[model samples]
Target chain A: MSGKSRRDFLKSTALIGAGVTGLTTTAKAGPQNILSEDRMGVLVDTTVCVGCRNCEWACKDAHNLPAGNLEDYEDRKVLDTKRRPGTDALTVVNEYSHGKNSSLPIDVKVQCMHCDHPACVSACIVGAFTKHENGTVTWDTDMCIGCRYCMAACPFQVPAFEYDKALNPMIMKCDFCFDRTKEGKLPACVEICPVEALTYGKRSDLIKIARDRIKRNPDKYVDHILGETEVGGTSWMYLASKDFAELEFPKLGKNPAPGVSESIQHGIFAYFVPPISLYALLGGIMWITKRRKELDEEVK
Target chain B: MKKFLALILVLVFTIGINAQQSPGKDHSKLNLSCKTCHSCDVPTKSDPCLVICPREKITTVYQKPEQTPELITINQLSDRYGPVYFSHKIHAQMSIMSGGCENCHHHNTSGPILKCNSCHETSRKREDVSIPDLKGAYHRQCMDCHREWSHETGCNSCHTLKKDLKDTKNESLQKKYSGKDHPVIIEPTKLVYETKSDKGKLVTFYHDDHTKKFGLNCTSCHKQESCTKCHDVNNTDKSKNQKVVTKKTFEDQHSNCISCHSKTENCSKCHGEKTLEPFDHGKKTGWALNKHHINLSCAKCHGSKLPYNKLDNKCLSCHKGWNAENFKHSITGLQLDEMHSELSCEDCHTDGNFGIKPSCDGCHDDYSFPKQKPGKLVK
Candidate 1:
């Protein structure tokens, strides 16, 4: 390739890269292409959960991990402290006592939120993460460069890096059992829930169901349905007897994560105007300087 | 077109045959439309679409507490927990005091009372999402009361560890509860509420009078009352007050009584400075229930919630069977002569009113009730 042409190509590539990064995120809320119309979701009525932790056992078994003795999952002593999803365990049930007086503590299962416009997918520079049609945010290990940008960008702090491994490392999080679902099977946790605290259905239908539940049981449930609109929307929703804030769920607005940044990105890369304008200004300066130099040479 | 015609002809013939072959159910007499039970226009054997029994209304299965299975082993989807030794009889008895068999068997159309797994799926991941799963149904039923009374979420309360299933602690508890009757709650005769209202400081309730005298069933006023209403051990004064968060008005508290009693008139009747005594039949009605009437309920004769004015204190008004033939004349401490015995009860008892003094003029200027004797008195 000629030098001039190569320089032009590099300049255009950098401009395109800047535009792609810019268009990745915004604070504005709206419908996005990431979530399909009938994307499946899980409605978690935390009020119905009995903190049995059978789901934890099923999750480990499905992932080909050692689940320990299945009977030991019922010990419930491990719930003494709050825990998050980790490499060892894809899902963990945490027991949160509402207040000092409440005898019954609420159990919340921690996993990936799988946002409609996932911040992980947005932050992954290599385009490794993908939002599946089944509402699962999955990532390909081969494409990942061990950047761990997804872990930093995740609002829920879900993704765990296998830093202990000196060999090939992998990011760990709940995949929503995408492979199992694709093969006409239910997600491991959802299939094993005895009390049906976790309800699986279309994401649209789940929102309606959550709303209907709150409407029918005014006294039994708080009005809010978490993930219905928070961070644009998520595949996993929650309904609780107490306020979600008291349960330690992060408060979020009804804005698509990629709204503001995408706008700035589009504006800078619109019809190659930014790069072309820069080149034109540089060309004008070079022309003036070259003319001055020629004039000085002639005067000499 | 020919195939369609043949199909219609077959359908008509089938309908005709069905009508002719059907036994005497008297469908016409029942005045039931075809859609009453069937959900389809043409109910076929393949997809009959039989309408689901309405579950909103509690359909009672006629099961006495004693007739029900006393114990049930709940080991449907458990590996870690042992089969729960459910004390069914005790719970059934408790259910009667609160709601009836319909409390648990709310959708029981007929036949045996259905188990939770009969309708509810054992697993959560199923096609139908309307009804809860077996575990959900169990917990929902139990927690409705346990939440209010025990306030416990401990699985050990209902479930024992599989490893310790043979432990004496669990085994003894299972044996103690299974096949045993629940302790009967001795219903209080009277209750007094210290109303915080300015109009009525105290309200005295005659609980036994409503049961024995008024003939009201336990369920009439106690509908939807869980065991927690009375048995909540954790409900101390501060908690009890806090639990009654749904602010009820003064009239709302008195709503149950207002259905029969005057709500606006005579506030002092129920609202007294002190707790009042139960209503005495003799003191209130000027006629005490003697030996024969003592055990009988007021509705046995009244048969209606009418005012006392609607009932006249006539002997035959209630004693319809006290005719001349059926009446045990000897029980009156007298065996009448053959002639007098053959006569009707009204013959000597002039107005046929036993309360009134009898005249003898009806038979041979016969013996009056007090002055003269009809025959040798047989005690």
Candidate 2:
């Protein structure tokens, strides 16, 4: 290659790199290609919940899923076990015994947190998961490879896969009653929560309302808010009477599960520097080998 | 002179002897006392100074606190033999109406009011004689009348009984101090709700004003009878049942509460007036909260906060029930408990509400977002 042409190429590459750096910097919290405007979400109030499993039942009904315990349903034996929402169930209410009359018993509802910076969204090779403008993590089933990467990526342990379906299988999780939310209605779980344990409203408004409730009844709830810091803040927020950890919510590291992996991948593959350096070193080795081969041939 | 000196020395010696023996005795008496006092020192003679005066003698009774016998309760006795708490106040109240404690008191023929131990000794020769040692005496006297007064022989017969013994000791002491003492507390008779009324017509109970606001004693309405007398559902007709079913009676009793409370009258109280539409419980007086709270089960959230509907449903209010740590997430895990699973989203996101948004910048001082690639702009 000509030296003038090579210099021009290097100059163009530097310009391209600078442009990429500027664009990437602007993308954080800025107007970008948001997948959809309507983001699905949920609101949980620890104070009002009875742990009756009515919302869990409603989710099952809406999804046409089977009951948790059909045999001893009337006896309510299933409640004896603490469970997360599985492939069959999208919502599960677990009972937390605060103490033996030392404190009040707290019941927590578990479901997909539907994070703003979804680990599942970043983990997907097929780009099935994407963030919507309204703060929902939506799935594009057409592009899903059923690799189960989304399952491992979710900080909430949501998204159960249909192992029973051999062909064209799908991942199941609370879609935040997306269909219902789009119609300007609260999710079925929110509608069915008898005690106003679950409320529905705009994400911004709901946060304010929850704050007001906590301010008014400071003695009734713990100070920590669940999901606010989880996976870069999930759209679904929760107020727990007990600490979030007591309810089994994970205390994630400063870097969200996906952010850590993304950083590692970026650090290695961000630019062509590492690979180009390796190629140069390999070419040098080959030249030495060629020199030795020529010297051996001349001696022969 | 010799005779006078000898007489004087003898007199001084006698006086010295008298002074040493009985310092406080009259000297005139001592002059007469040598022969008088020496006469007792002789065989078979009682000394006048050491004479036993029957009038100055005294006898004291030793009583145990348990056996002190002021108006002991069956519970006080029950602590010894599993509690069968009989209301002494109630028994005494009834006995007072029947003239006095004399109705139950077994008086000795000599006219001194016989002590309970006088009849009910440690052990009885026969059932008739077994009036009850101090324990049985109190229990029998109180329980016999209580049985006839209330007539329910269950645990409610006595063990559940309560009494005001505050003034019992003073009243008993006053009786001993003067004959003009009364054990009875005179109260003006007010119209009380009698669960055992002859008519099955649900008693018009003014429980809200009396019990809810005034904090009247539960026994005021329940009275001596079990709550079952009015509430028993199985016994629809008060007269015709072979055996009185107080449990069934309560079912009928609840109807009375429902009548005044309009919400309990129909399903619409909870399900909405227009069956097709939702119930606006939030707007109603009977309904303190909305369907969400009601569906979650009021008892669960307000389990311990019951009857008082103004309970705070804040996470901290209930979280203290689990553990108390100001501004820390240490109960179970990172997630909210099941009870708080349905809380509002804004609760955590905002700056004010104990929201979970800890500034990542607070800990990750060196953290930064990666820059964008060329042409991969957000806008």
Candidate 3:
């Protein structure tokens, strides 16, 4: 075959292969949003957090990250204090003391709640952030340009940035492990928690569970579901001994975080429309170029 | 120069012929010219490069070197399609085990076919759109092979997605081979040398124990990342040999330690803080702190680390400069040595301030301590 014919044949074969494969795709029925609408979240019961830092260790282990200095709990006296969730610390349990009268100080485990209307998703200009159907607001650091807007937008101050990485800085937060979720597993924190302070389940199911726990022991927990209404809902909920405010949880606005920014993003970039239009425009331009080339050839 | 040029031309022709052939060709038979392309005579090397490099080393690869994959432009897609853990060795063995290779052989008359990417390429675009470009190529090959194995063998046949998948099942296999003892020591990584001897009273520092039992939060000494809080240059008083600021005479380390330990849920473990240090009752370390213990909680006094077993039972132990000898009981007009030695001082002298009158008659003779004789008063 002539070289041109050979090339064309290969191209055609490739296209045919694509068409064939496209036809064979196991067409999954339903809303096609198996991942969407499945809102995933974390229910952190601070009252149950023994402050063992098992979740921290488990998290590092899951990510294959370096072991923190508190690898051994013996002679490990740091838990005597309160701490904030930091770069390495996606979640931290801070001990808030309300004197001796208020039933011994409880350690509040703080991490990204993976909100229903994630502010991080809106703040991410490059679309590095996404809220999975299971309600996990995860980030792709590879796409991240290291802007800390998500940190600011988050009412709970969830997303933290790695300031140490000068060249390829990234925003670190609890992903709820979207990768693990796709494979049908619980988040690392939930999986490793010996004491079920961090429980992973379907968001709706978890809400009911939280309500049941509160109803069963009326005096033990406050009546409200923390993530049920906080900051347009978070996948990771909280069941506390006292008022949520006493645990230093922020009183968030009613509207979901992504409302304003997502609309703007859709308005300006128009979701799938812009990309689709761009593809069409490119096809048109290519056709015009080929036509013009043919015309020039005819003239010659 | 002309001979060299002719040689170059022949080399170019050979290279062009080789390039036209599909990838995964027998490398030994191939003869090529590097100069034909590098010499800048040819416009470009139209043939694409095989993406054989490990994913860790190279973040992305072009489907066609000239035409960059559009999906790669969507940075999230690269993250979505993280590297597949393909064990080439295992797959090769599996292929051989499955009736000497015709089962998976491609290219018409192949005996044994290897290299998965040979058939699987970006050409196989799926409808999901989400599984477009290179991802579809990977998924079809991997998932199809895995699905086939699942039917033929067991679930782990190809879907050995987890590292521990095989070992977990092997437990049952081990039971089947009962009575045959094959002791196996699966060493993960060998240590080159012994850094520390296993001699002496080695403290079994259960790093995993405290963390496992108490959880990461049970640790009271370290920061969130587990770095020892006291030793982290920033927290400790460097001048004091990095000793915890709260720690003074070991007693202080004991006392304040409880106050600190009381924060976490597991309080009784450390708050009832006991140390293994030997204590001598003789060398009275004296009650450590000042007048603070009088009004303070007993936890503060007994809780803090003092010199082990040191006691100060006498008045002078805590109350220095006060004359325990010459200080008379002015309330009852009694001398210190006369009436207060055998009698408990608290019986008369209730308050520590020494202002309250502690006279026997004050309680017994309700009217007056000094009896005004009734006869003299009547006159």
Candidate 4:
């Protein structure tokens, strides 16, 4: 951000002492996460989705999240109430009205956006979260301290902390089916979408495709492409009939979310000047208070 | 002042020359206002500021089955299955019987049937979020019938399995649809149903009378019906015999006739003691639909919702708009001669109805229809 924030960031790494090298390396990486140019994306065409929750079932099954028979997902009653992605269900589809007084409803599937500049990785005090080169924002369960800072940082509110687990808990969210994609398979949700509403491809190629569609069918679509530039780009994109805000997507800026937090945190720790001054001030107060007590005891 | 005028003239000449440099596409000839294409008031090469896809003034389009495309290859989207070879002609012809060309080509503004990709995007990765993608479009259209008939959607039905992954189990589908005819829909003359009505158990439906005498189009009553209404078999599904669920509730069954006819007030019209005979125009209205009127649709004379008995028997009541130029006089059994044909029908026939017999008293004092021949008698 500014010279101040940059120094603060450097000072924090300096204060870490022995692990300073590793922390500094991660901070540089965190600010500018080097991802493959060919990192993939999933384009969710909400209009094509029929509210058949097959993708939801497939996601649960793939994640081993205790999903019932996939056929039961056919009952569209679940869509009557809008639901968000939780620990058990990695992905969920929510229904929004297509237009004013319109009978037809648009089904928008919600999950992790897998930001190019991930806020979770930035917010994690420990180096647990990773912005993988393949465009997946994943977290190491063993390293997770259950701080839930990622939950606060994520713009989409994707990551959920397992509050019920008394012994061991972990952050849960869509991993973009990282394991499956590594094996040359599609994400479970993308693979199972009956209408093929979710199209998986290179992010740049997907943007080109989306722009082409908008140009060809001007009457059918709004010009803007969601997730293309929102919060400095995300791997999971969306296409909807109405304004994305009406579809329950939060209004975001072109600037990445982590940039806001990183600037302040970095500024406060810049050059170790504030921390050193703060500690000295506290130490002086402690010394004065003890000296005052000693003088009172000597008088007694 | 003279130098300024000359500079202006030179500027105009340079602009004229620049305008002529671009040829062939004559935008000025279209007589459209510059604002139609140009977004800026003053357009230049660097900042032409052209508008894209201005959707106003949609013209209604019309097409017939024979005039539309015959076949199409849908291969834009890549998946495991091979692209479908769709029999566009066969489907078009079938639609002609059911709902005409608009059954599939629903949103034509003007010109020929629009390509599917015109409205539907070819790829799933698209910005047009209102209409479906090409794959979705094809499936949604096809599944209207496919889902209704079989209630199962296996990809191999429309798409052929890829050559490398081809199995013996996958049926040879590409060859089956060439020039395939959906068998002619048979119309029954009458159907007598036993209804739950306490006043009358039987309800006789004169199907032929409604179509022939009443002149109702098949589509007027069968709106929103699936092809599986009659073509109910699932021959494509390998499953031997799945129970076809072609159930219609009371409302669904009665919705067609009830739109115009009174289902609440006029129960006796349809409900009867036993099977009733076919509708007789002579018995019903005291005037038969004779040779001249028999082939005509009911709307031709009855004016869509106009009652059969309400029309005056006078030919002029319905033929008020017709004149000698439009009403072929030769079709009336006698070809009018050159001299007499010049006179309007009202001049010779004092009465509006031609059955009153024509008189030649105005022209020839002693002449009449049988006595004097004004026109050649073809019959």
Candidate chain B TM-scores, in order: 0.66, 0.22, 0.17, 0.54
Show model 3 residue runs off by greater than 4 Å: A1-37, A68-71, A74-76, A98-103, A261-300, B1-379
How accurate locally is residue B114 in candidate 3, as Cα lDDT from 0 to 100? 31
In what order do the candidates fall by DockQ, top score first? 1, 4, 3, 2
Candidate 2 global TM-score: 0.38
lDDT of 1: 0.78
lDDT tens per residue, model 1, B169-244: 5467667776678876788777777666565667778888898778888877777666865677776663211222
| Model-by-model DockQ, in order | 0.21, 0.00, 0.01, 0.06
Better model by DockQ, 3 or 4? 4
Mind giving the per-residue lDDT tens digits that candidate 1 earns over A1-300?
565787799899999998776676442233245668889899988988877787898999999878987667867688898898998899999988855225466889889989998889988999899898889999998998889998987878899998898988989899999989999888999887756788888898888888889998998799999999988899999999888988778888888666556667888899999989999999999999999999999999
Q: Which residue pairs in candidate 1 have backbone atoms (N, alpha carbon, C) closer than 3 angstroms, thus clashing? A: A23-A262, A25-A258, A25-A261, A26-A258, A26-A259, A26-A260, A29-A256
CAPRI level of candidate 4: incorrect
Answer with 2 or 4, whichever has the higher lDDT. Answer: 4
Top candidate, metric TM-score: 1
The CAPRI category of model 3 is incorrect
Please write out the lDDT profile of model 4 over residues B1-379, one tens digit for every residue.
9999999999999989978654336655764556656788987778877776434532223544554445666777647667666777677666755666677777653433357787777655444444556766777787556644654444545766576454432244435654555556688777666656676777788889888777777877765555665555643543232222324577766776787675665677776686677777778677776678878877778777633337767777877788767777778778888998888888888765676678888788778887777787775
Candidates ranked, most accurate by lDDT first: 1, 4, 2, 3
Report how far residue B264 has shifted in candidate 3, in Å: 44
